[model samples]
Target: MLLLLLLPSALLLVPWAGAGRIIGGWEAQPHSRPYMAHLLIRNASHKFECGGFLIRPDAVLSAAHCVTGKKAVNTTVILGAHNLKKKEPSWQVFHVGHWVIHPNYSKDKKENDIMLLKLKPRAKLTKEVSYISLPRHNEQVKPNTTCKVAGWGWTSTTGDETSVLMEVDLKVLSEKVCENRFQKKYLHQSMICAGDEEGKKSTSRGDSGGPLVCNGKAHGVVSYGPKYCVFPKIFTRVSYFEPWIHEELRKFVLQDLPDSPSSD
Candidate 1:
């Protein structure tokens, strides 16, 4: 039963030939539902349809590549959200006061592909919009462990957008099996693999920067998908980056505002 829950989506390796084409002036279909969500920081404009988790009242964790190649000053992080197509009464938009990408991040290999964003103003905590706890360094989740992945990415290749926060059960995969499957071409120590190896209901496009959570804690950040978008996908391991995260958080707290309280 645990293994079955980790199944990947059948569309992993399938190609969307027209994925590059834009329809209705929208880069891609708007995620079906949008609420306090992360925005994809592109060169032109930002879109609030990706996954993210509030790590602090004023901080959010997401994929580094999401904001790469874009100006940090112009970036924005939309939170307290619920619907994407239309504005909700609780939706709030905050400017990205600053951003910190892992210094060792590699676009070619997509290593250490995590990033942290500091929002202009702190968010108000609530049940609908809240922060996810960070996993302790050295904490390990055994293989076949059931977890949950949430995102606002595309639902299907030809299907319409997905809800603001769609969650699916998943399981962790052993490093050995993961390496053998991807030939180590994408998997790295800083990343963990999850989903059904057989490809049944996996994460896909626009899901990048989302969270792979377990026991109410954030264990990984969505990074890459199967080249074909078929099998289990890889996520940046949050545990391995604990030191860097703390350092960045400390720097942000000191420089941004001393009065800012720590989430921990």
Candidate 2:
């Protein structure tokens, strides 16, 4: 049986698998992934980072655990960034206007682990910054599907987090295989699994909240992995939350519209 451990907590004792990097991946081409968003979040005690991706002109999709239950006091989204350590001309920074975590998110079970951040001012779309398309309505990916997962973080379990963006190719595993590997009670239906079986390549301590892009569509949100990231990792299956995402986007648009004129 596999042990159940949160990536953040595991990172303290086991410096490798937590809410931050890519393991066994290579540097991504600058601005190649325009939808990518790097998050700098501060709580009362300290500051941390998480990965996210632009989903709309003013919205970003990420893991709920990245913000909620962490006492996140303030969060900033940086788009069009290639090397986080350098302030490039393409960077578009925005203060979070608001955020919405899934209503039924369960920290213990790690279910419904997704969230959306609304930018204070809508982002200006350009060649270097835009939104990634989501999975088609109710679409599902099959086993053995090759996908890409990208983020700014460690490229190895024992390595330092990288400043430049990195990405790796992963293969989706079947639901049955995932259940057999992870604790059944902790593994929810809404989550998907992906990674290399040999453990050669996987998401590590800083890759959380990043996307699993399958066939050019945003299909999953990086959730968690084992202490050493030795096998396939868990991701919040985006298709499961499509309806809720669309609904929230609709509400946001409605809120932005001017009030209707008074009746005569």
Candidate 3:
């Protein structure tokens, strides 16, 4: 039974993971989902540490748990690269400026697991790099509706990370099934549960913080799932936190950030 859980169980919601693309999925067209952002420690490990998207020219949205205990000065945001392993002309890397984690985020509780990254000098937008629109605060796609998830994470739970972007489509499971599978209060308005109940395809480890694109908008952030990515995947509902995101962006990220090349 696929269910939401308070414990992320090593999938996501634990600090420090790079959300790779989809497992049991197909490669994404080059530059598709251009808002995809890769986070890592510069000159550290060649592996990306998390996945994010450009909500603004200077701002990125990722999992708070992924960046916890790490300094913004030490992090790098890689944008416009479908393949991180190669040097692509469209790729641009930026250092982080503001490290804003949700004030109520609880590592122990594994709830409210989201954060914003301010790109130093902002990010340059090109044909290969663009933005994803956020789901309206009250918008929602019904259960069983198909949504797409993309990432550069592992193609399998134990497989090597894919060098290119991958994509998979998943159905939104009903809340009743989610309630039965997870603990009481595990499913909340701020969170969403969806996946293949048949154990065929889903995002696994190294795919945390990626976007769950539904109805051509970003409605969820890849949070976590079962060990093998079989169980239903959990996502932080973007609609529920619309105010929190806007408040922070309006107060901090909007001011004093440099313009992207396209914007200028």
Candidate 4:
């Protein structure tokens, strides 16, 4: 009976294209990644997860597909959390006040897949909560550059979901290589390709929208990957959209600040 039941679960390991999660990675040190944000999004029928990072007290960066058809009322952003199952005192929860998806984002083409979330109430800066820096305008990452991505979700296609966050290091690949693999129609210049050449490490289902941190800065956003999660994954290049990000943040990131207590 056990074998019978387990057979169905085993079939889930089969390859299929979908959102990705961290694979071949270990648990991240609690609260070490202070800017990490875990998003819980709901559609009409069910809830799903995505990853994001804080860019400002009131602004977060994620993939457009994570919220393409979702409503603000059904979305929740959780920051300062290392373990999603625990009631960590450092956790900060917020509702999305607004969403700013790239105007050219296309779900089918998977081009320009980026989005920003404006927190309803600005996140309070603390030891476990803060923001990360973005790359300079048009600053591009070279092929073979090493970067790290983190998120909380399935450890493998057939494994149980991880309660704590996880991360893995991936090496960027050349544009020519990516274009060859995904083709020009799918792999736009605005995207990045990264993963282990041997297919040992990758991002599998549930890790979409996470940050790809390189040199202490976020350079990419997790977008999609292969069905088996064995090949290189594609990320929305952060540097390519720096100008648009700045313009959006400038509009309302500082609005309605709470007054500080007056000192006599």
Using Cα atoms with residue i matched to residue i, what is each candidate's TM-score against the true structure? 0.79, 0.89, 0.85, 0.87
Total clashing pairs for each candidate: 25, 6, 12, 6
Candidates ranked by TM-score: 2, 4, 3, 1
Poorly placed runs, candidate 1 (over 4 Å) = 1-36, 45-49, 70-73, 186-188, 258-264
- Badly placed stretches (over 4 Å) of model 3 are 1-21, 42-48, 70-73, 257-264
Q: Pick the candidate with the highest lDDT.
A: 2
The CA lDDT of each predicted structure is 0.64, 0.81, 0.74, 0.80
Model 1 root mean square deviation, Cα atoms? 7.1
Q: Estimate the overall C-alpha local distance difference test score of candidate 2.
A: 0.81
Best-fitting candidate, scored by TM-score: 2
- The lowest-lDDT stretch of 10 consecutive residues in candidate 3 is 11-20
lDDT of 1 by residue, 1-264 (tens): 334334453323311221111111222223322223556454445443346678888788888777665453356667765445567666677766577889988766667889888876777765556777888885777789887765654656554564445566678888866665556444555788877655556666666777888777788887775454445567789988988989988887776566766432
Q: On residues 27-135, what C-alpha lDDT tens digit does candidate 4 reach at each position?
A: 9999999999999988677787899999999889999988776553478899999989897889999877578899999877778889998886789999999999999
On residues 1-264, what C-alpha lDDT tens digit does candidate 3 reach at each position?
323333344443343322344767898898978899887743333434678888888788988866665433377788998877997999999877566788988776657888888776767888888889998886777998899988776777566678788889988887876665555535568778888777668877666788888998888888765443456777889999899999987766436546623211
Per-candidate RMSD, Å: 7.1, 4.6, 4.6, 7.5
Candidate 2: how large is its RMSD?
4.6
Cα error of candidate 4 at position 173, Å: 0.7
Better of 3 and 4 by TM-score: 4
- Give the alpha carbon lDDT tens digit for every residue of 70-123 in model 2: 687888899999998899889999878589899998776678889998885789
